[model samples]
Structure formats: C-alpha cells, structure tokens
Target: LNMANMDGDETFESTLLGEAEEVFVERIADDECILIRGTKNHSSASIVLRGPNEYFLDEMERSVHDSLCVVKRVMESKKVVPGGGAVEAALSIYLESFATSISSREQLAIAEFAKSLLIIPKTLATNAAKDATDLVAKLRAYHNSSQTKKEHTHLKWVGLDLHEGVVRDSVKAGVLEPAISKIKSLKFATEAAITILRIDDLIKLEPQKEDKKYGGCMDEE
Candidate 1:
C-alpha cells in the first residue's frame, strides 16, 4: 500500500489504480457486475486465473534466461587469470621472516629483521603467535655459541638473506649454487648477530647476561 521511489525522491507519486486504469478498461468487458472499493491512493488487489499464472511464469523464466546470458557474455569478454599462488608464496616468505625476527633472542639480528619486514604491506603479511615462537626457537638453536661454531656460518648468511634480501656480492655473483654453499658455512651466535646487524644498523640487541652472585672473601688483616 506504501509506494516511494528507490532513490527517496518525493516528486514521483502516482497511485497504482491511476496507472492501471487504461489496462483494466481494455481487458475487462463487464463493468456493472464488479464492485470496486477504495480510493486511488488506497489499497487494491487483482486475482489472476490459471492461464494468467502460466503466462507470468513464462515471463519470469525468460527474464532469468536473459540475465544469465548477459552475465556469461560479460565474463567471456574479459579473460582473467587468478594469480593467487604468486601472492601466497610472496606473503609466506615475508611472514616467515617476520616471525623469525620477532622471536629471535639476538637483539641486533631481530631488530634488523623486523625493520626490513615492516616495509611489506600488512595485507600481504601473517601475524601468528605460534609461528613467531617457533622462529625464535629455530634461531636460538641454529645460532647457539655453545654449538660447533664453524658449521653455522653458512646458516647465519642464509638467515641474513632471508631477513633482508641481502647477501655478499660473492654469493650473488656465484648465483644460487655458490650462495647455498656460503649459507651452509654460517654458525655461531656472533656471526648471526653480526649478519642481522649488518642488514639493519638499528638492531643493537645484546645477548642474555648470566646472573652472577657475589661471594665475599674475608680480607686478611
């Protein structure tokens, strides 16, 4: 019973009876037997027989068919390939490096790594707490000073490359194979910390200090 324009415009106001008056006169031959109640601005109802129902149903079916055809034509006109994998791979690498930097106990290395990863857009990044913790554990185990120092040198280089996308000219010049070799030699916390700091100058992180208890020695007079 309520009618209004979709755009909220007040100017367009006309009763349904006023619009359908001509159609009703043309379709209906008998007017004396029918008693119509309600004004032009009020409510109205029309009963359709089975034949009219079938006609309306056919119209609806045609409308749906036409809509689908238009949609298919539009889609065919534009050939688009969804590049989800490329984006996913790039984001995975970025997030993995970010999490590693965050959980790193080596302050200098972590600081540098964080700075580099922050440059990437937030939409392309993942922020999972578990991943961060795991990365920290990995860094701690790989760069332990107590472990064999010589072997971890290569690992340190690889970690640096992953964090900052930077590596020695020799590694770059040698390409993927030589770079892999250099990465294999990195070992020890000092090398890891140094490499991280080299990439990010602001990573002035210090190692964990051991707690030393004071034991007083009695002075001999």
Candidate 2:
C-alpha cells in the first residue's frame, strides 16, 4: 500500500511503493488465523501471533506495537539499552549514588525516588510468578551492592531475568529496549508522583448547627 503523506524527495519514505499482490488469507484449525502479504516492488514482512484468549491476543498486539515504536525511536536516536528492567536498575544505582552527594533533606526524597525505580523489575518478577523480593535483592547485588562492587563495578547491563526469576545479564539474553523510552517513562512518572504527593486540601462541614434543639422545636411547632 502507498503511504498517503510524504515529501517527494524524502530518503526513507516508502510512499509510492506498488500495491501488494498474491495476498491470501487462510484459517487453520484450533482457532488460528494467518495472512500472507506479497508486495510488488519491495520486501514484505509478516508476523504470526497465536494466543488462546482475547486478553492474550490484545496484549500481544500491544507488545508488537510497543516494539515497533521502540524501533522507530531507536532509529531516530541510534541508542538502545538493555531491557528486562536492566536500564532501570542501572538508573536506580546511579540515582542512589547521586542522592548521597546531596546534603539536604532532599537527599531522603531523592533516595526514596531512586528506590521507586526498582518497581519495574519488581513488577516484572511478580508478573512472572516469581518472588519479587528475592529477585530485587539479587538485582541490587548484581548491579550495586558491595563485595561484588569490584567485580560488577562496570557491569551495569545486569537485569532481572523474569522468566528465570534471577538477576542476570540482560544484554546477552536478547533483552534490549529503546533507551529513550525508559528515560522518558521515568521522568514522567517521577514528575507525576511528586505532583500528586504535594496535594494538600481539606473540607469541613458546619458542625450540625443546633441539630437537637432545632429539630425538637420544629416537631413541637
């Protein structure tokens, strides 16, 4: 299909590509569906997603969309980071160190905010039916704790392996994500959280003015 809006001399726009040919749709047993697309003048890519339930199918669709978005973002920035909460873990460690440099009451707030970043890994572990506490403890050591400080000092790519319920090298395990996504997500979350936490409002009702005497006089009258 032709991309509707594009500049004439744009380098990477697939705007005027020819229509697809030999397209076919097929239905298989066991609630499966497939579509095979054949483009005329370019390479065509296809994906097959099969899930037993509607929720699973929708989630898979969302994941595919997210990955495509990440790819587009990475192409624009040419920077990527290890996924599976590895990037978050690294940021959490950095924030903790940075927090120590602050010498005001804000240090405590900074430290607590840093701790909140670990929620990514914690939720990942919990969703995989693993113990979030154990995984987070291991991840803290894998990325930040002492004793391993000398050995793991420069290895900031370690992340929670949710499937295995362990803290391991996410980069080597094919877990990579767009760096910009994580940074943006963290910034937005932190701002939203701080804004919500600062809210202070109160309401009071005029304390049932003359409730008993007024009601008794009304009844008697």
Candidate 3:
C-alpha cells in the first residue's frame, strides 16, 4: 500500500519519502517526528493538522478525537442501534407498557421516565423547524403500532429524518450510533437524577432557616 497516497484525502494532505534507502530513526529536540519501531502488522499512523488560528486547530483536534473515540467504542461493542431518536422512542413505548403493569407508586416514576425519553425526538423535531408536538406524537404512534404486528417491525426504526423532513426507518437511512454509548448515557442520566433526588430528600429532612435569620437581622437594622 502507498502510505503517502493513503493519507491524502479531501481534508488532509501528506508527503512521505518514496526511496527504499535505509535511514537512521533518531529523536531530536524541538522536532515533531517520533520514531516508532514495530512489526508490519503493528504499525501506527500520525495525523497532521493546521489551521488559521489556535482556536480553530483546538476545535479540529477535539472533533477528530471524538470521532476516533466513537470508532473505538463501536469496535469494542460490535453493536449499534438506529439513530435519529428511534431507539429512544421505542424504549419510551416499551417502558410505558411496563408502567401499566405496575400497581405501586413506582408506576408513576416509570411512566414519567418513559415520557422523558420522548424529549429526544421532540428536540430533533423542534430543531428542524417542524412541529415538535405533532412529530413526536406521530413517532410515538409508529413505535406503538409496531408492537401489534410482526410484519410492521420496521416501524420500530421509524424516526424523524430532519434532513429529509420525513419519518422513516433510520437504520435503512444509514443513521446509526454505538449501542454502548447510548447505554452509558442513559445509565449516567439515571444515576444523576437519583443523586439529585437524594439531595432533595436530605434537604427536606433538615430544612434550613438561613434566609429567615438574615431577614430578621435586616428588619431590625
């Protein structure tokens, strides 16, 4: 493979020595090059970036790093889900059904959690200058209907494709995301919400009168 040619894409250009001459690989002060001695199967590639200013370069680096992280996560899990909020909408429908089976106060919490999942599709619709309420309602209807038919399974992947201004199968539309990332995000969000609720309970258990103390002093002054 031509290593130099492989690096030259639309957004980047690279040059490499073509001769087979043996040259000493040495580390030098203030030099960007770092020698990597490894087998052919264990080779590494370097990226070079340039921009008009430091801010642009920083942003570019961040974006490239995030892309690589996504690739790594996808490789680790070897799994993906339909994007465009399709999974969230489907989960919302399933959770709502589960909430109906519960008889305790937990049912209300589960139902609210299910409702919160729709915010993803709602935000997508609103950002696209579409009617968020109508679009979310329609998306929810699609996923709910999927549970009734074996042949309409594709409806589970139905979500708003903002670019096309239509609801369609996101998986067929080539919109996918790393399944592990989604799982991690939902896990973190739930943990955070639980922590916040604990803090609120602690506050309620020992109500502070700090405001009243200062208010009384001000009135006397």
Candidate 4:
C-alpha cells in the first residue's frame, strides 16, 4: 500500500507477509517521519526533543533521565512510599518516641535526630510560601493521631499539600515516591553529616591585611 504522503515518483511495494487486525500510518509534517501503530508489543522506540537553545535541550535531557530513573526504580523495587515529606514526618515521630525509652545520654542525640527529620517538611512548607511552623504543627498532630489509632486501617499518610497550602494525606493526594530512593537519600545524607562531624581537623583562612602606606610608606598628594 502507498501512503498518502508518498510522492508520485516514490513507490512502496510489499507482499502480504502476514495478517493483522488493524494498522495505522501517518506522515509527520515536512520531516516525512512515518508513525506506525496497532502493534501488540513495542520492543523499541525513539525520543525526539526539540528546543530553540542548547540550555533548554540540556534541561530536557536531564528531565528525561530523571524520569527514566524513577521508572527503573519502581520497576526494580516494586514499592513506593508517600511523598510530600509524609515519610519523614512519620519517621520523626517514631524516633521521638524511641528517644523517650532511652534513659542514657545518647537519648539527646536521638532526640536531635528526630527533630532533624522535620527539616524535610519544613523546607517543603517554606518553599511553598506557607506558614512552616503552623503546617508542621498540624502535620505532627495528624501523624500523632494516626499513631494513636487502634486499627491499622486508621493509619494515615499525612503530608503537606503545597497546592492547597495545608496538610493532607499524601497517598490520597497521589503524592508518592520510590521507597528505595527515599531510603538511599536518608542513608547518604546521614553518612555525610556523620563524616563531617567525625573530622577533627579544621582549616581556616586568615584575612589579608591592608597596606598602611602605598609602596614603601609613600603618601599620596
């Protein structure tokens, strides 16, 4: 069959090698790119990005890479957690309770660690131009309420709804993130912080002194 976009001088000849239920062919603009459809399985595909400048193209490439990473993460782990800082808030609450059980001096560190987790939600609320203190308090209340519930079904995935400028259930709002990614992020961040704290040596740069006279005590007129 000849496509409508085909020129009179150009001809496509093919024998009926197989039978298919349906087929679709369309010619793309001046590029003459042909799009074929009605296939049960697609083994490969092409991605084309067009932009007026290199900066935009670079950004598009990075965005595409991140999207692919997320897909691969989901495929490999097959597990996800609530996003919008819900997980962080929940972890913080748990850690706080855990710190209370410890009577040793180490409890201070654990308590601080628990407070550190709130930075995620605080940063999110700050970025969204909402009242970070108020929203965080509300989020803490939601998580605490969920924790006190006797039934597992009452558990909530509470987090900030940036769009609404309030706290809500992240899972119900469709805010989700790869569990592995979140775990890796926390692991790496904690390790880096610990490493910095373990370092004993400190390097400081001394400020340069201003010359009292211009070139060997010479005074300007």
Query: Which residues of candidate 4, in runs, are more than 4 Å off?
Result: 1-40, 50-58, 151-155, 208-221
Give one digit per residue, the lDDT tens place, for model 3 in 1-221: 44344467534234432333233555444355645544344345557777888799899999999989988999999999988889899999999999999999999999999999988889888888988888788888899999778888868888788886778888888888999999999999999998888774333466556667576355654
Name the candidate, 2 or 3, with the larger TM-score value.
3
lDDT of 2: 0.77
TM-score, candidate 2, is: 0.66
TM-score of 1: 0.16
**All candidates in order of TM-score, best leading:** 4, 3, 2, 1
> In terms of TM-score, how similar is model 4 to the real structure?
0.75
Per-candidate Cα lDDT values, in order, are 0.39, 0.77, 0.82, 0.82
Best by TM-score: 4
Q: Which parts of model 2 are misplaced by more than 4 Å?
A: 1-40, 43-60, 145-151, 204-221
Candidate 1: tens digits of C-alpha lDDT, residues 1-221 = 34446776555444332532323223443332344444355465644323256688678777777766645644654432112112222333444455665645665544554444323222222232123333433443443421346754443322212333322222333222222222233234346766665784454679856545524444457
User: What's model 2's lDDT at 131?
Assistant: 95
Candidate 3, which segments miss by more than 4 Å at Cα? 1-42, 200-221
**Model 1 misplaced stretches (Cα beyond 4 Å):** 1-130, 145-148, 160-221
lDDT of 4: 0.82
Candidate rank order under lDDT: 3, 4, 2, 1
TM-score of each: 0.16, 0.66, 0.71, 0.75
What clash pairs does model 2 have?
none
